[model samples]
Target: MLQMDPMRPLDPALPITPQLTQRLRDRIIRNHLKPGDRISETEIAKVYDVSRQPVREAFIKLADQGLLLIRPQRRTVVSRIAYQDVLDARFLREAIEADIVRLLAKTRDDALIGTLRAQIELQKRVHADDLETFTQLDEQFHRMLADAVGKAGTWSFVEGVKAQMDRVRFLSLFDYPMALLIEQHTQIVDAVEARDLDRAEENARQHLRLMLDYLPGVIAANPSFFDLPEGGLAPSVNTPTLGGEYT
Candidate 1:
């Protein structure tokens, strides 16, 4: 029952493993590969007319990102989102971005404000149903702030740690208010432009904390997609029923 959209032929000239890794990551994040769905290295290899070696490499990379579960002598499956992982990622993001906005406010960069304003306009133009495009724009908006402060590498590190958070976000995109999100983006930009460091930092922190407010509802609506206990905490990793056993 696993269905994937048609993928373009792998470029013969470029390295294959990273390409496969990114493509497979996209499929996983977009829900094309649901949690607990079994996947075959051989099938994916054949899909791109490649050998299994690169496919295996891609699987291992994704497993490291907590997006894929690789079991020895068994099928590889998409991982259910770990509640702790999402919380930890949001914590890290808020810590970094809140400071980034405050720094921007201190500097009061006109060009940066202009760039963010343009980005906000682009976000508003995305149709409400076009969650994928809005998500991309949202990332771009944040990355622009980081880039303004020479923290692009830091942003990359955050990106590496946020796969689980991104999965939950993609799930909630349909119902989450895109307009409110855009407003938050505007608030941060406005605070920075006004050179109010305290207000900018607070706005950034509040914006990032929206995930905490939204996560419980997302989990309630899609209980099967997460690995959470009755108390709403992440279960120990060694839990046999959800961990060792592959359903």
Candidate 2:
């Protein structure tokens, strides 16, 4: 069983229900609550020193997110990560990101390009010693790029899907080379600065491809983290066919 710190702080401003819901969601994404694990609202309330009413409300929110399944008779379990869902989410993300790059190339925003360059430099420095900070900045860099194209809302949708893949990403961080990621970001920035749409798209595609390539190894090492079919493992969300064309 995965153990979690009971004393973790809740978002003080949020209603107790949403606070609990977000906490549970975080636990699930962080791999502290594995798929198909049974979760009891009563137990959670007790653990968090909260009332059952709040826990019940939280569970409902989680169920709506597809992170939890509420069965008949008040039982709830963490939903298994569906392979098709992952594929669909990745497909949408790739399409949106490709569009982002095309828009960015046309705009040629020097200020935004400079910000991205600074982010890449920070990514290199922190990645060597502190992966946690590097991960946060890495996410910011991508978001910043999308924002530059006036697609922050689109990127938020992308992020919702990406959240489902966080566990796999966390696992890959242990084995994958961070230097390669930095280099990929740098190349994309260079292409954008040159106002080369085709080259920027190719670079972005390559960066996502690297992530797709790493999925197999991640699943191999942490089989329990994935939702594999009975007969064989499923392909990752970032399959070549899905991301090949801009939609």
RMSD of each: 7.4, 3.2
Report model 1's TM-score to 2 decimal places. Answer: 0.90
| Candidate 2 TM-score over all chains jointly | 0.84
- lDDT scores in order: 0.86, 0.75
Cα error, residue 230 of model 1, in Å, equals 5.9
Off by over 4 Å in 1: 1-3, 234-247
- Residue 12 local lDDT, model 1: 80
1-247: candidate 2 lDDT, tens digit per residue: 2344675865657678867776788888766787788888778877877888898888887776667889969678888665555556666676677668878988998988888898898887773657768778878888998888778998877866666666567666767678888998999999999999888877887677666677677777766656777778665544344346432
As for model 2, its CA RMSD to the true structure in angstroms is 3.2
Q: Residues 102-128, candidate 1, lDDT per residue (tens digit)?
A: 899999888878989999999999998
Clashing pairs in 2: none
